[model samples]
Every structure is written in structure tokens, then in C-alpha cells.
Target: MKLVIVDDEPLARDRLRRMVAEFPGYEVVAEAGNGDAAIRCVREQLADVILLDLHMPGLDGLQVARTLAELDVPPAVIFVTAHSEHALSAHNSHAAGYLLKPVRRDDLAAALARASRPSRAQVAALAGLDMADTPAYVSARTREGIERVAVGDILYFWADQKYTSVYHLSGELLIEQSLLALQQQLGSAFMRVHRKALVARRHIVGLRIDSRAGPLLSLRHCRCSIPVSRRRLAEVRALLEN
Candidate 1:
């Protein structure tokens, strides 16, 4: 299993690293000095589990866990902290395990063995992290690193060959998800213009009947005209008319 360690203290990180080395079949993919770096590591490494600390200078461990819970496939989290008093809060975060500071090798081993993915219910309980009430953002890989683009800002999602591309006014990025997944996760905010495309209804300006393409969708803040499939033409038209 892949693992990511997040802690601000170099000594604590080193200790955890050494303990993790004692176990087999576990690869330490990356280490972060703070929650921000940990979030980046989680996205880049696709870690199976995260060894998170409860308190840090910028984003605390709970904040990090809350952020991770919002992800499509959030990794399991095990909080390694001295504040056992926050156990209930950690439990609410749906943490796989909570290991107190001055962690023993045996305790760490037990937590590792019982690691489990946080359920959607657990994520929903995280205050100010719920996106179900409104549109949320998704993380996409970029040249610099992973970036979170608001679902509202997304002009469309186009499946070009192997991967899906997310387009926005700022730029476009190739994401590791099927177009269908985007349509389903994004809910009614997007309309399926084609099997390979999902265009944001907010960005869609108008629909036009094209002699060659059959139906075309005009989107705001975008130069290229989108092709609306025959099966979805009526739906797209109705949405635009509304």
C-alpha cells in the first residue's frame, strides 16, 4: 500500500518514516511538512493512506482530512497526534485510526492493518466541506501540479481518446475520469451534448441547427462551437430555452 506522511516537525516525520520502514509491502511515496504539501502529495502520489498530524501551522490535520473527504476517491487517514482529546472529532472525520503521539511500532502496525476508506456520510458531516448543496471544485493535473477548478468555471468536459479534458476560461486540463463520471458527479449543472462531451449549462448561450453537424451549441466565454448529438438535441434545446 502507498502512504503519505504529513507533519510540520522534521523529527516527528523522521520517526514515523523509520517506523514505517519496519513494515513490508508499504511504500512511502512522499512526505510533507504541512497540510498544504500533504494535499499536493496525496493528489500527485495517489496514496492509499495518509499518516496525518492533528495540528500544523497552516492547515491542521482535521482540515486536511476534511479536504480529502471531498475528493472522489479519498485515501484513508490515520491521525498520529498527542491530543487524544480530539478522538471524537477525528472519529467524526471518519478517520481510519487515531494513534497518539510518541506512537509505538506495535500501535502503528495495528492502525495500518485496519485502514479503511472514509465513507461518503463521514465526508458530508465535515462542516463547510459539503458540496452537495452547491457546486464544488475538482482537482486536475497540470504542468506545475494539481489544481482545483470550480465546477461552475468549467466550460465543458471533452473525452478525447484515452483521457477526459476539462475546459475553462483560464485553461484546459486532461483529467483522469470518464465523461460519464463528470456528468454524474456534477449533477444538473452540465448537459450532455454528446457521448464524448458534457457542457456546463451556465456556459451554453444558445443552440443552432447546423447543416453539417445537425445541432450546435454556443457557449459563453468560449470560441469553439460545440456539437450537440441527435439524441440530446431536444434536451439541450429545452435547457437553453429555459
Candidate 2:
């Protein structure tokens, strides 16, 4: 697997690179001396995993991991640090593994064996961020990584069997967050037209009645029409006419 080793210390980075090189099948794709550099390197290299050092000059390992989670395709992060006190934070961040400083070869291998994306709680803890902070943006999970979609850009939100798909001006992104939760968090900006869907209040240009499908809601920007349930038809029209 491809790996990026991030450390503020040159010697620490060198030691890690050398040690990782000794391990079979793990290629050292790029190295960064600090969080900013690490973010850039990971974005450029698209490495499979990152050996992240917790304490750094600007953004620490926790901060770096949280930011990286927003990427289109984020890599698995494993914290390698001297501090054992950060064990809880590391776990919350959904890090694949945590290795104490003076990392051993065996431990490194084991950590790599368990690499995975940072969990929602971990990322939130790292940044002291909340999922329902405001109505400006919402988080969506794409195949590659987590993405922040601007509220204005979002056309609608639809719930499928297992996932809630956020349809936006840019495109659609599947998110694990339930549509009800989205409606609650997004507040007045979005209004639900069906039990399974929430349409952007600002995006509704007109309402239509489909002969075959019944009621339909059209958007000024989106080509696709949203099905409006009978219960919500009057309310949808009220908002549209206003």
C-alpha cells in the first residue's frame, strides 16, 4: 500500500521512511514535515494510508486528519506519536491504529493492517466541530471521501433504502445522514415534500401535475422533477407562489 509519513522532525520523518521502506509492499510515496505539507502531499499523491505524527508546529495530527477527511478520497490515518495520553482522541478520530513514539517495525505492520477512514465522531472531536453547526453547508459521503456541499448548491435530498442522496447543482452525493436528520439540521431553508425527500425551498421554481405520476415540483436549475405527495402539495404550492 502507498503511504505518506508526516512529521515535523526531519530525523523522525527519515527514520520512519527508512523503516517503512524495509517493510515489504509498503511504498513510501511522499513525506511531509508538517500538517499543511502533509495535506498537500496526500492530495497530490492520493496515498492509501498516512503515518501521522500527533504534535506539530501549525496543525497537529488531529487537525490534519480532520481536514483530510473532507477530501474526495481520503486515506486511512494512523497516529504515530510519543504521547499516549491522546489515545482517546486517536480512537475518536477513527484512526486505523495508534503507535507510540519510537515505533517498532512489528507495530507499524500491525497498524497498517488495520487502516480505515476516520469515523464521524473522530473528525468532529478533532476540530471541535458539530454536524449541525449551521445551514450554510452539509456533509456528504462520496466514493472517494467526505464532501461539504453548500446549501445554495443543493437541489434536493432523497432517501433511498440504505442511503440519503443529496442532489445538488453540481451533482448527487450519497450521505449516511438520514433525510429527517438533514431536514432538522437544515431548518427553514429546506422543506419536505415527501417522506423520503426534502427539496430546497429556494430551488422551487414552479409546481406541476404529472398525468401519470400525479404531482410534480420543478426547479429553476435542475432538469429532474421531484414528486410531491398529496399531503405536502398545498404547502409546496404556498411556498412556491410566495
Candidate 3:
């Protein structure tokens, strides 16, 4: 199978490349350090499988998987992660299989075996999106390189002229996609808290309405006070009340 591997760590990429070479049926077609490069690789070269890493500098594996879900011929996914907490989530995402970090040969083979099988339509249905809609995952190029961060991980999105900055629990990432396009694609989980910002409901810590400052929304672990537009204040209040 033609395969692509994406991870941020150089050692991890090298190790996986070596391991993939050892596998008889699988051939490493491309290797990328971030999700953006991985997407470009997959688009340029038809891949049967993608060995995706869960965490990276710019984009995480889940975002890449979500983006691929919108493709007509999405490659089978085998998620590689160090954390055990993500295992259930991967299963929930209907990943072909998952391998723990410092992957063993046997584990790689097992994941490949799972990938070779037919995919369930139920898994596709769970993505909850049509292809025409803006993808839930956006590819961004950062100083560290290209990353694929999931829309769900994003605490908020802010527009900066030609660029859109995505703020997540990890950090901020800049993407070329327009903020308006992102707002439309982001589901109800994200709301327009301000004209310049779109905030994720899950990340919202508290809402404070000031007669002077107007309505303020705070994101968890985030220090910045996000302004809520007059039109969106009622909606924010209603959401918080519920």
C-alpha cells in the first residue's frame, strides 16, 4: 500500500520511516513533519494509508483525519500517539487502528491489517458534514512548519486581514484561510463573540457584562478578555444560561 507518514519530531519520523520500510506490503510514499505537508503529499500522490501522529507543532492528527473525512477517497488512518487518553477518541473517530508511540513492528502490522479491511459507513456518517462545506480542519503554515489543528481544539479564531489566527489550548496558529470561511464551517460549537473573534463554547470560562466594556467572555486558561458584539451578547448570554 502507498502510505504517507506525518509527525513533528524528526526522530519519530525517521523511526517510522525505517519501520515502514520493514513492512512488506506497505511502501512509504511521502514523509511530512506537519499536517499541511501531509495533505499536500496525499493530494499529489494517491495514498492507500496514512500513518498520522496525534500531536505536532501546528496541526494535530485528529484535524487531519477530520479533513480527510470530506474527501471522496479518504485514505485509511492509523493514528500514532503517546497518550493513552486519545485511544478511545480515535476509536470513536472510527480510525482503522491506533498504535502507541515508540511503535513496535507487530503493532504496525496489526494496524495495517485493520486498514486493509472495509470501512464502515457508520464511521463516515459520524463525521456530520458534506464535502461541499468548508472542512473542519484547516491547514496552516507556521514558523515551525505546517500543522493541522482540529477545529474542536481551537478555543477561538481571529481575523487579521489576509490571515486568520487559530487559538487553541496548545498555542496560536496562522492559516491562509479566511476567518469568514472558517466561521461558516465551524459548527455551532463556535460563536461569533466579537466582530474580529469567534470563540468556542467549550473554551469559554465565564461571561462578564460591563456597562463600560460591554459584554466580555473569557476562555479557559486564556487571559485575554474577548469582547462580545452587541448583536451577539444576547446569544452569548443565552448560551451561557443554558
RMSD of each: 14.9, 13.3, 15.8
Q: Per-prediction TM-score, please?
A: 0.49, 0.48, 0.49
The runs of at least 3 residues in candidate 2 whose Cα sits more than 4 Å from the true structure, single-residue gaps closed, are 116-242
- Over 140-208, each residue of candidate 2 has an lDDT whose tens digit, in order, gives 666778788766567799999989898876677888888888877766667899988898775688888
lDDT, candidate 2, at 116: 31
Could you tell me how far off, in angstroms, the CA of residue 75 lies in candidate 1 after the best superposition?
A: 0.4
Estimate the overall C-alpha local distance difference test score of candidate 2: 0.82
Query: Candidate 1 lDDT, tens digit per residue, 96-118?
Result: 89999999999999898666323
Q: Which ten residues in a row have the lowest lDDT in candidate 1?
A: 119-128
What lDDT does each candidate get? Answer: 0.81, 0.82, 0.78
Which pairs clash in model 2?
72-144, 72-145, 73-144, 92-122, 93-122
Error of 1 at 114 (Å): 1.1
lDDT of 3 at 95: 89
Q: How many backbone clashes does candidate 2 have?
A: 5
Q: What are the runs in model 3 whose C-alpha is more than 4 Å off?
A: 120-242
Model 1's alpha-carbon lDDT is 0.81
